[model samples]
Target: MTTLELHGLRVRRGGRDVVHGIDLTVNEGEVTALLGANGAGKSSTVLGVAGLERDTAGSVTVDGTPIRGLAPNRVRRAGVATMQEGHRVFGDISVADNLRIAALLLPSPARSGAVEEVLALFPELETLADRPAGSLSGGQQQMLALATALAARPRFLVIDEMSLGLAPLVVARLVPALRQVAESGVGVLLIEQFTQVALELATRVTVLAQGLVTLEAPASELRAHPERLTAAYRLTA
Candidate 1:
C-alpha cells in the first residue's frame, strides 16, 4: 500500500518553531484526521510535509522513499496533492479552466481523461462547466477545489480545513465525497477544526496541542472514550 510517513517533523515560522518533532503516518485507503485548535501547528505541519515551507526540518517519505526536501511541484508529481485551506478556485476563469489548470501536471494524453473523471466524481460541476468559478456559491467553490485536487490523481491527499465557513448542509454533502475518496484507496490526511465531523470520517486520529502531539489513536478507541480528547483541546486552546 502507498503510505506517507513523517518522522521528527518540525516546522519553523518567523524564527519560531510552530511544530515540534512529530511522527505521523498516512496509509492508503484510510482517513487520518489531524485535529487541533487554532495555532496548534496543524496547518504548518502538513504544509511542511507537502513541501510548501522552506524552514521545515524532518524526514518525509512516500512508500519509504525520502522526499522531505523536494519542491512542491515535485512532491505533487510524486503522487501527493494538497487542497489548501479556503477556496482555491480561480475567480475569473471558467470552472473547466480551473480543472484544466490542475490537470496540467498529468501527461498530455491523460489530462483530458483526468478532468473528465474528476468532473464525474463531482457531477454538479458538469452543469457549471462554463460558468466562472468565482460565481459559484461557497459550497460549490469548495467542491471545485476538491475536484481540482482529484484531477491530479493523487495517491495521498492532504486537505487543510475541509469545513471552513461551510454551512452544516454543505458540509454534510461534502463529507461523504471525502469518505468516498478514502474508500477508493487514497490515503487522506484531513485537517479539520470540528472534532465531531473529523471523528466521523477518520479511521485514525491525531491531536496536536501547543505544537506537540497529545493524542494518537484509532478512531474507534476515541469514539468509545470521548473524554480522552479534553486534554488535547484544552492545551491547544
Candidate 2:
C-alpha cells in the first residue's frame, strides 16, 4: 500500500538544516495531511520529495525506485507531482495552453483527452479554458493547479499551503477535489493552514515543529488529543 517513502531525509537551507532526519510514508489511496504552523518544515518535507531543492540527503523512493537524483520532470514522470503554493501557472497563457505546456510528456491525442479529464473534475474550468490564466480568481487558479497535476496522472501528489488565502466557500470547495482525487486511489500529501480542513480530510496526520516531526497519529486520535497537537506546535499559551 505504500506509494511514496522518505527515509532519514535531511534538507538544508543556507547551510542550516531545516528538515531534520524526517521520515514518513504516503500510502496508496489515502489522504495523509502534513500539518504545522508556518516554518514548520512542512513545505521542506514536500519539496524534498519533489526534488525541488538539491543538496538534500536522503532516500526518496517511488514504487521502490530511487528518486533522489532524478530531475523534476523525471520525478514527475515517475508519478510524483507537486502543486506548490500559489499555483504557479502561466499568467499570460490560456488555460488550455497552460495545460499543454505542462503535458510535455503526454502524447497529442491523450493531451486533449487528459485536459478534458481535468475539466470534468473541475467543471468551472471548462468555460474558462480559452481565457488567460491570470484572469481567473485565486480559487480558480488553485483548481487549475490541481487539475494540471491530475492531468499528469500522478500516483502521489505533494501539495503545499493549499488554503493560504481564500474565502471559506472556496476553501470548502477545494477539499472535495482532494477527496475526489484520493477516492480514485491516488495518495495525497497536503500541507494546509486551515487545521479544521486537515482535521476533516486526513485519514492520518503528522505534526511537524521546527523541522522535527513531533506527533503522528490517526486523524481521529489527533482530534481527541488536540492538546498534544497544540503543545507540539507551541500553542500552549
Candidate 3:
C-alpha cells in the first residue's frame, strides 16, 4: 500500500514555530484523523504538507519519494491533493466549470472522464452543474470543493476541517461520502474539529496539543475509553 509520511516536520508562522517537529503517516485506503484544539497547529501542518506554507522544515514523502517544499501544484502532481478549509471554489464559475478547471492537470483525453467520476461521487453537483458556485448552499459548496479535489484523481487527500460551520445534518451527509473516498484506496488525512465525527470516521487517531502529539491510538480504543481522549486534552491544557 502507498503511504504519505511526514518526518520531523516543523512549521513556523509569524516568525514563531507553530508546529514543532512531529511525525505522521497516512496510508492508502485508510482515514487517519488529526484532532486538536484551536491553535494546535493543525492547519499549519496541512499547509506545510501541501506546500502552501514556506517557513517549514521536514521531509514529506510519498512511498519514499521526497516531496517536501514543492509548490502546491507540484504536490498535486505528485499524487497528493488538498482541500483547504472555507469550502474554497470559484464562486463566479458554473459548478461544472469548477470541476472542469480542476481536471485541467490531467491529460485532455482523461479530463472529461475525471470530471464524470467526480460528479458521480457527488451526484448533487450534477443537478446544479449550470448554476454558479456561489449560489449553492454552504454544504453544497463544501461538496463541490471536495469534488474539485477528487477531479485530480490523487492517491492521497489532505482535508483540513471537513466540518467547520455547517449544520449537523449536512455533516451527516458528508461522512459517508468521505468514507467511500477512503474505501476507494485514497489515503486520507482528516483534520476535524468534532471529536466524535473524527472518531467515527477514522481508523486511527492522533491528537495534537500545544503543537505536539499528545495521544495516538486506534479509534476503537478511544471510542471504548472516552476518558482517554479527555485526559489527552487535559494534558495540553
Candidate 4:
C-alpha cells in the first residue's frame, strides 16, 4: 500500500516559521483530515508535502522514498496529485479539454483511457463535456477540477479547502465522490476548515493551532468528544 509521511515538517515564509515541526501520515484506503485556524499553516504544510514550497525544511516520504526538496512536477510524477483551493479549472477551456490537459503527463496511448476513466467517476461531467468550464455551476466546476486530478491517476491526493464557498448541498454532493476515491485505495490528505465536513470524511484528524499540532485523534474520537475541536475552530472562526 502507498503511504505518505511527513516528519518534523517545518515551513518558513518571509523569514518567519509558519509551520513548526508537524508530523502527519496518510495510508492507502484512508482519508486523513488536516484542520487548522486561518494562518495556521495548513496550506504551507500540504504545499510543502507536495514539493510546491521549496524553502521547506523537513522530510516527506512516500512509501519510505524521500521526496522532500524535489520539484512539484517530479512529486506528481511520483504519484502525488494536489488540488489547490479555488477549484483551479481553466475557465476558457471546455470540460473535456481541461481533463485532457491533466492527462498530458501520461503516455499518448493512455491519455484517452485516462479521460474516460475520470469521466466515469464523475458522470455529471459527461453531460457537460463540450461546455466551457467557466459556464458550469460552482459545484460542477469543482467536480471538473477533481476530475482533472483523477484523470492523472495518482496514488496519493492532496486537496486543500475543497468546500470553500460551496453550498451545503453542493458540498454534500461532492463528499460521496471523495469517499469513493478513498475506498479505492488512494491515500488522501484533506485540508479543510469546516470541522463537520472534515470529520465526516476523514478516518483520522490532525488539528493545527498557531502553527503547531494541537490534536491528533481518530475521527470517531473527535466525533464523540466534539469539545476537543472547539479550541482549534475558535482560532479559525
Candidate 5:
C-alpha cells in the first residue's frame, strides 16, 4: 500500500545537486521518519514529491502513476498533501478560512466534508476558527498547519518537522495527532530534529549522510542501536 514512491529521485538548485539518487517509499498506515542534518537533502527529496523542484531528474510515482513533471496542484489532487516546515499559514486570514483553502483544491462535495472532518478531529481549531491565524501561539500555529493539511483528506500526509520551534509540551501534544493520522490510514513521511521523539513515533527511520541514504531500518532497531546509526552517518554523538 505504498501511496508514494521515489526511485533515484534527483533535484538540483542553483546548479548544484542537492538531492542525489534518493530512494524513498511511503506506505499507508505507517510513520516513516527521514532523519538528517541540515544539508542532508531531506527538503529537496520531499519537494520532488510535490513537484516544486523544477530541475528534478528521475522518477516519482503517486499510487503507481508517474508524476515527474506534474504541477503541485495535480500532485495534491492525486492524494498527497505536504505540511511544510515553519508552519507557513496565512497571517491575517481566519483559522477556518485557512483550512478552507486546502479543501478548496478538491471537488465541491469533498470540500465541505473534509473541512468538517478536520474541524471535528482537532477540537482546538474549532474554538479558534474565527481568530486570525497570525494571532495564535506557536503551538496553535503548528496545529493549524497540520489541521489545514488534514482537511485535504490526503492519502499521504507529508510532514516536514512536526516539532521544530516549539516548547516540550507542544511537541508532546503533536505526537498523538500524528499517531492518529497514521491510524486512520494516512501514510506519514515525517522529517524530525528530535531523534528520540522521532524514534518513538516512527515505524521506520531513513538516515541521510552527505545527501545519500546511509542507514535505514525500523525505528525500534535504530533506537536500540544509536551507536550504529551514528557510526553509519559519521555524526557527532
Candidate 6:
C-alpha cells in the first residue's frame, strides 16, 4: 500500500521552532485528520511536508522515496500537493484561468483534461468558470482552492484548514467532495480545527498540542471516548 510518511518532522519560523519532531502517516484511500487548537503547529507541519518551510528537518516520504527538502513544485510533481489555509486564489483572474495555471506543471497536452477532471470533482465551479475568483463567496473560493490542488492530480493531498471561515452548511457541502477524493484512492492529510467534523470524516486521527503529538489513534476509538480527546487538548492548555 502506498503511504505518505512524516517521521520526526520539525519546522521553525521567525526565530523559534514551532513544530517539534513529530511522526505521522497518511495511507492511500484514507483521511488522516491532524487535529489541534489554534497555534498548535498544524499549519507548520503541513508546510514542512509540502516543502514550503526552509527551516525544516527529518523525513517526508511517499512510498519510501524521500522528498523532504524539494521545492514545493517538485513536491507536487512527486505526487504530493497542499491546499494551504485560507481560500487562496487569483483574485483578478477567472476561475478557469486559476485552474489552468495550476495545471501548468503537467504536460501541455494534458492540462485541459486535468482541469476538466478537477471541475468534475467540484461541479459547483462549472457554471462559475468565467467569473472572477475574488468575487465568489468564501465557500466558493474554498472550493476553487481545493479544485486547484486537484488539478495537479496528486496521489497524496494535504489540506490546511478546510473549514476556516465558512458556515456549517458550506462545510457540509465540501465534506462529501473530500470523501470522494479519498475514495478515489488519494491519501489525504486534513488539518482541521473542528473536532466533530474531523472525527466524522477521518479513518485515523493525530492530535497536536504545543508542537507535539499528544494523541494518536483510530478515529473510531477517539469518537467512542470523547473525553480522551478533551484530555489530550487540555494537556497543552
Model 1, 5-110: lDDT tens per residue?
Answer: 9999999999999999899999999999998878889999878988899798889999998888789999999999999999998999999999999999989999
Q: Is candidate 1 or candidate 4 better by TM-score?
A: 1
Cα-based TM-score, every candidate: 0.97, 0.95, 0.98, 0.95, 0.95, 0.96
Number of backbone collisions per candidate, in order?
A: 0, 0, 0, 0, 0, 0
Query: Candidate 2: misplaced stretches above 4 Å?
Result: 235-237
Please give the CA lDDT of all the candidate structures. Answer: 0.91, 0.85, 0.93, 0.89, 0.86, 0.93
Off by over 4 Å in 5: 235-237
Cα deviation of 65, candidate 2, in Å: 0.8
- Candidate 5 is scored at a TM of 0.95
Candidate number of the best TM-score: 3
Least lDDT summed over 10 consecutive residues: which range in candidate 3? 228-237
lDDT by residue (tens digit), candidate 6, 80-185: 9999999889999999999999999889999999999989988889999999999999999999999999897889999999999999999999899999999999
Please identify which of the two predictions, 1 or 5, would achieve the higher TM-score against the true structure.
Answer: 1
Q: Candidate 6 versus the native: TM-score?
A: 0.96
Per-residue accuracy of model 4 over 105-207 as CA lDDT, tens digit each = 8989999999999888899999999999999998899999888988888889999999999999989988989999999888899987678888999999998
lDDT of 5 by residue, 1-237 (tens): 766888998889889888888888888999999988778888888787887877898888878899876888888888888888897899799998999998897788889889998887788989999999999999999999999888888899888888899999999988988899899999999998898888999898888877788888999998888886677666432
Q: How far does residue 231 in candidate 4 sit from its true spot (Å)?
A: 3.4
Residue 43, candidate 4: Cα error in Å is 0.7
lDDT of prediction 3: 0.93
Error of 4 at 6 (Å): 0.1
Residue 49, candidate 4: Cα error in Å is 1.4
| Global fold similarity of model 1 (TM-score) | 0.97
Candidate 6, residue 203: lDDT: 99
Put down candidate 2 lDDT per residue, 1-237, tens digits, no spaces: 757988888888889999888888898898888987788888887777888887689799988999976778889998899999876888999998887777766767788777777788899988998999999999899888888888867899998878888788998998998899999989999888888898888888988888888888898987788787777786321
